[model samples]
Target: MIRILLFSGLFTVIITAVQLSLNYQKETEELQTISQQLAETNAPSLARALWELNATKANDIGIYLMRIGLFKSITIKNENGDTMVFLGEKDIEAHQTSIKLQFEYSGRTGTVGTFEYQIVTDIVKRKIKDDFIIILISQFIKTFFVSIFILFIIHKLVIRHLNEISNWLNNFKPESSFSPLALEADKGSSNEMVKLKSAISEMGQQVHKHSTGLEKVVAERTAELEKLAYTDSLTGVTNRGAFLQAANEELNRSRRLSYDVGVMMLDLDHFKAINDTYGHDAGDKVLKQVSQAMANCLRKEDTLGRIGGEEFAVITPGADKRGMHKLASRLQQAIAILNFSFLPDNKNITVSIGYTKVSNDEDFKAALKRADEHLYTAKASGRNTFITDKGFLPRIVS
Candidate 1:
């Protein structure tokens, strides 16, 4: 706004300066015309005085011309180059004009002398200076008020609303909900500001919608990654890490409650030979089927996991020595009855089991180690059998 006012003031100054220059030229020309008229008006009387050799009359005429204030000086010279009259100061810079003083005698006219005058410039300069001051003051006042009015109108109609829009954009957030943008000044008006508000509102909605969809996609991907981390890919059962974590939790719960938790380890007898003969794909299929069978035989409180190649573990909460033996026997029977078309008729699936009851306040790793030792013992004694901390069970031939 200040800039607008300055430019308007400068423009007014330039225009006024131009007008003053023209007025100066016009006033100078009018002075010249007045000087010419004075010379012509006094020429005849001056000429009669010079022809009659009357110096007094010419001097009187010159003095009257000087008193008029238009001429800086007046001088009359006779035809023989004699100065008859001189009045006032001679100003070399002033505008000068000369007229021939002619006197008519009978049928002849003769040039008697020269009438000359210099127009005073001081008077012209004074008038122009007065005019310049008046014009400059009036123009400056008019421009100042006009510039202020324009600035006010622009601020009310445009700049204030633009400030609101700027603030809204600065505070916008895609994750949080926000009220729609509106301008109170332009409420129902269908001007450009209203259109801008509508466009920004629409863009904000799209950003929020996309942000929500992105969050959902990220959540689903995270869940999938968690499943992959905790679950065995081939058997669809808890993997070794998940199993150990769950067993540890169970052990802690049993310690608190003063109850027994059965730990069991099972290894498929001669499982690698099946992989060598039928290929890894058949072995994977067997592992999947056997783990599923074991899961089916367990109670709701049991957790089955594939801890190693052809090796599985189970956590059975609230199970005593008798319950441990019973679950081991069930797992053995479930595996022996399974048949695979890809296997030789003479080859039957069998599992050797080792079982133990967790002692009070025993760590899960120690119980798991004890169960693994028992599994090794059962495998050494004979295949297709269950061994407990006490001794091996009677063989159940399949």
Candidate 2:
């Protein structure tokens, strides 16, 4: 648009200049031809011709020159350089000498023989200057409106839509809700925008899908790590650290509520003999079977874990001395019934169990120490029986 306006303005100026120049050229040519024609006539003809330029005819020609937008001054001077009759005036004062009109005539260069004249004016120059001003003002107004309209259309249709697209792309994030924006109404009316919108929609979907997949992978890995931290690698039962942590929490709860907490410490019967008789693999199987049997017999709230080599602990909250004894007997029975093929010839294995009940005045480690002693007693008495302090509640004689 700007280019077109510039070219149009330049073309207007060039045409105006050409028209003015042609007008000047035509006037110059007319003056030259009139001078040559007068020169072609004889001196007698020249005199007769000069007689025709009388006062009435000169006045008529002056009016004609004014009407035709010609020169402002016309005068004739003889070969002696003396000014004769002026077209628009009678004569110049001696102090105000006029410019001579020197035209060839009668095979001589005398200017109308003391009566020749020429016409000159500043009128045509002023008219051309005025015409140029008018043309420039008119063309400028036209060009201004054309430029504004063209720029307005471009901004509304193209620049605004492109800016929207650029902003959407800049702020988009993979974790955010990335639904593609609805294309502008004007954009939707076009097929190119529709295609662009579809592509952006697909990209958003792919980003959402990839984000979901990444989240799932992270969650699964976290779960696996948690299991490894809490569970025994060989038997899939709670490890020593996990069991102690849980038992401490349960003990704290029982203390707060004035309830009893029971802990059982058990060990496999003749575990070293089994590992020596068969192999470490068979010993591992026996441990797994015993752990599984104890787990099956216990409630979900009860905790069981492998605390050491062939040694295990079980915790029962809200259980008294009698309840702890009964639970120990059940665990012993469960271990006796476990069908383990850990021996050299697929022989069975049993476990000895011992348990302690926490009293109001005793700490958890003290109770655990008592349970360890009881476990030793059970192991010494028989490989498959359980032991507990028979007088734990009856002998509270304080």
Candidate 3:
């Protein structure tokens, strides 16, 4: 806003200056033209009237010249230096800075009288104000529209995309492969983060020979624990390890870039009731279906894992409060659309979600706890709703 105002102010000043210059030039030329016409026509007629001593004709001529609205004062005099008629407000002596027109006889035999007039600056300035305002408004409107266009282009092509890429890099891990980002526009762009990941993977393979004896056994055991830590054996999605690793990487990157990271905690609603009513086989089928349904809603860059038997975690890099809410809503809808067939009658599945964002000042762990608290609030308030940093989810009527 300040920039727009400054731009408008400078433009107006420059235009006003040019307008004043043109007004002065036009007024000067107009004054000179009118002086020539009056000398040729009015002066001869007035000289005839004066020679015949006709007061009425001289008075009419004086009044007509005054009504022209250009002159502030008009003085008429005879050859004897005696004023015949002075019809004006000011009575200043005619000298320099005044226009003097000397009248002559029918054929310039002798001088009859002189008409002296002065121009008004205030009148010229008043006329210029209208054009001045029009020019100012036109320039201001043009600047306003152009500024809006520039901001829109910057936001669409630069700001939004840059923030999105920064977030993707924050969530990326050296151990993981380069996956497609969430943004459809970014799908074709092979970013630096992917190259870095490829390089790290190649380096890890080269160092594989160092694992020998105790080192080999320890590595094997560690790999087993890591595999168990991140993946749910039944669902085959991300495990706790995947969620934690991504979250940690995002937090570390966010600290440097000052980008916001969002995380969601989701729990399957009434899963125990489904298990108690049906067998363990039915429960497993429902769990797999629920995970798959939610996964369909997520982007390739997003992380979704079964952290526990009935609870899942999602990490969204580069999401603010609104972004977190939007993702949560989509996941809720995906879960709502699923249908279960193992039961005697068809049943619908619903999940409650909690969401929070890690800002520049926060760590990922604190943000996770806040999200969990909101999740607990969501579960306590109702069974199948989402609670976010903003508030509880609004119920959709449709």
Candidate 4:
């Protein structure tokens, strides 16, 4: 851009110089022709012809010839190496130079002279010079303003957009938050810069899409891993580890909010006997049926887990001692009503259940232990019955 502006300035100067030089030369030629005619004739004819030349024309011719000598620094001279007229600043002694002229007449020829003179009173030279100066100054001013305008446009529209793109690319980072680039397209230009911005926008979109896809893949893999870690292989419910973790979380929430929580420990009565008599396949079927029944009985927020061989644990949030009693009885009755082919002879089966409400000072592990103790008590009293914590105070109907 700078180079273009500079070249324009230089071009203007050269053109101005050429135009001024050409006008001066053309005017000077006409003046020389008139001067030669003057030199050809006698004095009376010369004087008459000179008088017939209008004042304006004479003044114009004199000024035109003078400016040629003035600008070129050359005086008009005759053949005899004498000055006919001189114009401009005269310092011709440096070169000791003169000009040549040929004089002609109707019947004879003559010689004229040349000499250096410092004075320049010719009006045409001054006017031409003044006009040339005005033109040159005007062109220079125009060129300067044009250059400034072009530079300003380049900085504002081109340089500014490139700077913004560079900064965005440099600072780009991947995170949960998404960053977007939305630069405005050029209004009417179809230049290389516009194409480049379009390409960059395309690349940004592709990169963003790729990042989003990778994040989704990673999330899916994480979910798969969590499912494998927490689920039971045979029962399709939570494993012991997940059950404990879930119960602990629920217990903590209950404690913080002063809410009641209950735990139930259930075991299929004579489960080992059934497995031994009817094979493990029948035992597995019975386990699946019991798990489905528990799932049907539990709410969405309630948790159930397979803790051991034919034994299950349940966590009920916001359930007090009375609620625990009712839930345990229901679970026992549901199991009693279940008829499984565990013996291969198609005999009915039942489950013993024990439940306990979480106390304010007790943790999940302690509460679960108490529920286990109650489970053993129920098994000792009878194989297919349920027992709650009779020691719990003020049992209300759940």
Report the error of model 3 at residue 381, Å: 1.5
Q: Model 1 Cα displacement at 95 (Å)?
A: 4.8
lDDT score for residue 320 of model 4:
68
Give RMSD to native, each candidate. Answer: 6.8, 8.7, 29.1, 11.1
Stretches > 4 Å off in candidate 1: 47-56, 73-118, 121-125, 183-190, 222-398
Q: Each prediction's TM-score against the native?
A: 0.63, 0.59, 0.41, 0.49
Clashing residue pairs for model 1: none
lDDT of each: 0.85, 0.69, 0.73, 0.71
Query: Rank by TM-score, descending?
Result: 1, 2, 4, 3
Q: Please, what are the lDDT tens digits per residue for candidate 3 over residues 1-398?
A: 57866876797779777977798779866875675476456877777777887867877898888788656666677766677777767735532133334445455677666666665445666767766777777877777778788776666556666676567667655444445455344444444544544554455444443433447688889987877777788997888877788888878887788776788999988889888988788889988988898888888878887888889989887776656677787888888777766654456888888887776777777888888898889999987888886543444445
What's model 2's TM-score?
A: 0.59
Ranked by lDDT from best down, the candidates are: 1, 3, 4, 2
lDDT per residue for candidate 4 within 105-205, as digits (tens), equals: 56665443332223222545776789788997899889989888977788676886787678777766544354565556666443666667767767876
Give, for candidate 1, the lowest lDDT window spanning 10 residues. Answer: 389-398
Candidate 2: the clashing residue pairs are 39-105, 39-106, 71-120, 71-121, 72-120, 72-121, 75-117, 76-116, 76-117, 78-114
Q: What is residue 356's positional error in candidate 2, in angstroms?
A: 0.8
| Candidate no. 3 TM-score | 0.41
